[model samples]
Target: MFIIIPQTPQNYALRIKQHAERTANLDIRSGVNYRGLAGFLNRPFAEDHRDATVDVTNPAEPPLVCVKSLVEGGRQTARSYHAVSDCATFEQDPPSLVNKAAHLVWLQGYPAPEWINAIGAQYRVDPEFFRRHLIFLQSKDNHDFAAMPSSAQRMLTLRLTTICHTQFALRQTAIEAARNEATNAVRQHQQRLRTGDSVVRKYSVFDNTIFTIDQELAIYVERKKQHNGWIAIVCSDLGKDLTQGPGGLSSPWLGEEPASPPACEPVIMHVPKLALKHPHQHRFVNVTSNGSPLMYQNASLLADTIDLQSGGDDIYLDVREALHDVFTLIAAAESQFLTMVQGLVDREIQLQSSGKQTEWTLSNLRYFKSSIDDHIVNLENTLDFLRHPDVPKWAPHTRSPRALSREGTPAGQAQHSRYRSPQGEAFAEYSRLSSLGDDYTRLLQRATKLSNRCVENTTILMNMAMLEESKKAIVQADGLTRLTLLAFFFLPLSLTTSFFGMNFRELGTGSMHMWVFFVVAVPFLLFSTLLCFWGAVLPNFRGRMQWAWKMFTSGAR
Candidate 1:
């Protein structure tokens, strides 16, 4: 007979297969059983007992049994035959009968409640005592327990029932906790998300800030690049590193080759001369290869070609120098961006640590605003000059009234005189007043906006801080309340000690012996009363006392 059990969701078939493969040297495959139960038993469950008896007194053991049957034409023939058991016939013998009884009970669906009750009755214990010791056995490929032994199978069924009940209870608690955590997480994320607009505005402000910084950096990079280009050009012109000879100067220890004199190398000298005189020297020389003084003609042609090539090489070097400067400027711009980003990040961190938000500082923003205003002003001034009728058409021309007067006294001198002075003065005054008014207006607008933003942010932070402080106060108050309750709990003891300390001889005939006895007896009585008070009275009084305190404080406050 065999017992069947279903698989649990938590079970991992591949892991079980791996474990079996490692421990038993078996190639256990996953999925529905491909191999027979016998192979699985031999590989993974090899430790399972075939013929074992268990003592029924030990809750860890379940009843077991053996079967004997005679088959005719593949049909079982039931006959009364002696079968092995787990209960002993005698006290000293192993409990073979108990194992047999348990196995029989297991074959009939384990009879969970009945088995638990029977075990409890026999051991004079609770049903849970027997159920807890039970272990579940499962199939290798699937978690099905159909092939397990009868006695072991019954224990497994009861174990599963108990575990499922426990897991169900735990799952409910976990689900509740998870729901609460998710609620809190959503609330927190929502709070952060609400700040998204502010964050975007901050980014825009930061962009403008960095734009101003980059303008300065661009100027610096351009200057540095130009300086670097000049240095490179100067170095190239000085013939530095232009030789094909040994790097710089060769070491004396290395044997030096004898230098060939220019005179001995007559062909070298003559070729340079011929090349200098003839523009198409190489073509001419090729045509007159058999002509007289061929070596001298070749030398002259070679020299001219060398000089031209040298000049072209110088130009190439200058171009390369300029390219290096541009690359340097590009590299500097990249470095400046990195530096600026790092600085901004550091400033943000500092502000956060100091309990301030990044938006509170308008320094960078103000700088950018000022730069834009200045740029606008400069553009307007240039436009004004371009529109001016009397402005000089070109450089080096005078446009002053005195120059105009020196050229010729116009017939409309009185008209020029009539409008010039007053118009010029009015224009000057108007320009100054207009600029002042514009500057003042812009300053006022920026200041007002900044002030309003500050006030709004301050209000938000203050409210948040107050809320946090209130929460902390509530927690502290709770702790203080507990301490106060504890202190009040010992009030009776304190009162008793204080009462005993006072000399009270008003009761009966006062004597020295009575006084001494009162001193000892009163304390002993109070101590016993306190113990009884703590054990019984405190539990009863706790709710009432807490209520009274709440009422009294509510009224008093």
Candidate 2:
């Protein structure tokens, strides 16, 4: 299974003879088994069976899983049986996307470097270049990989198991192809959403958001807009944390391996990550759009139920990270609403009046309130996705002193040799995210208060409008009253004058005396009516008439 080559040309005859004998015994004509080899390597996320019950609880051992291995032998194609009986896929690459295609397939399961080199030769770059140089540039600033555990190796097999079991080789350009499709769709949609006259980097607000990240710098952001031409920009920031070694430059062994580059950081190597439970070593993989999350988990390697049930500080780091990422997103949404609120408040204050529906209205507040309720529920659901699982089967556990002692273990003593995960530095970062979630909840409350204040302002403005209408109504009523009184006072005198002028033989004769009475009486009545209204109604009528004149002249429309 191994060879030790000496760096010498000193024994050519003897070495040639030995090589010939070994080659004769072995079938040199046999081809390499790439498919079975790939399938065997598929189990990246394996359970070490560190838990004893997995094997014992099995009713019976499963039959050997076999796949045909097809390899190239010189000019001919050849085949072989690659049995997955107690396959050591997990044993091969463990955590890194090593066996699978990641930066460089430098791990155990990949075909020999010479084979990969042969393929690379067609593309004018050696497979050795990655093993030699490029990989060193990746994963520099992340302590995240360093702080994880062997159980985390489950991450690797997530995608591999799917790719192999579903029986498809990892596409050489899967990311590239999917990326072009997704980017084009998103870019087109963005173009549709943007107005041709839109400006950038200004104090404007929006109802939706698009986010982007500078991959190389690791500068992730939820941007307000999808800046034009940004799709063409490839963010090629490999992490700086790589090549600095797992312990970093501060390690005492700086004097070691001086020839080659510094040791690589412990990469959180995986093509996907989701979660579930399994026996032996079941693996899974997920692929997502750029800046989206993927899941990889091996469920069979978890702690006991007692520890997992303990809430609060005892959750897994992956769970914590998920929670943090979600809350951060929710907070971004709230921030958008808050920004709109700020602009509206400024406009209202300037106008000294509640703006109309098309400008700024109560509906904005109402929509904001409804959104808050919906999102809080969603936030709870997000947490539930992490919690609602057979988590005890894969996640690490940490029990408090009392819980540990319930099994009668002493304070400083160990408990059942179970996997007790520590609250490592990684967990601390996740905790910050959790705290940020709380902050967003508080921000939501503040927004609710502001919403209330806006409602109150609208109410006050409405009342003032009612008062102005009431004052106009009073003035119009006074004018109508004066006109009614004048008509009523003249009624009897006008009737008498009409009777005298009838000129009927039985009714009466026309008379100059009647005319004299009518003229005198009408004048007296008019004078009395005028005196009655003169002081009391004049001011109101003049003011109302002036208002009507102003309305007619100014063309209020």
The lDDT values for all models are 0.28, 0.31
What is the overall TM-score of model 2 with all chains considered together? 0.31
**Clashes in each model (backbone N, CA, C under 3 Å)?**
26, 22
Q: Whole-model lDDT for model 1 versus the true structure?
A: 0.28
Error of 1 at 166 (Å): 54
Instruction: Give the number of the best model, judged by TM-score.
Output: 2
Candidate 1 wrongly placed segments (more than 4 Å)? 1-440, 491-557
lDDT of 1 by residue, 1-557 (tens): 87543332112222233343442234343322322311322332235635422223221111111121112122222111111232223112211222101101111111122222222222222211122221111223343433333222111111000000010122323433433354343233223321001000010123311221111100000011211111110000000010111221121111122221011011211123655674552322222223311111121121112221221212111222112222222223332333343355446435645877444334433433343344333334323322222221111122233334533556434434433333352111112223333443443344344434444444555675689799999999999968766665466556655655544465533433345655666676676567645767787789899999999999999
Model 2 lDDT on a 0 to 1 scale = 0.31
Which candidate wins on lDDT? 2
- Reference-based TM-score, model 1: 0.18
Per-residue lDDT for 490 in model 2?
A: 63
Q: Write the per-residue lDDT of candidate 2 for residues 125-174, one digit (tens) a residue.
A: 21122221212222232222222323222111100000001112224244
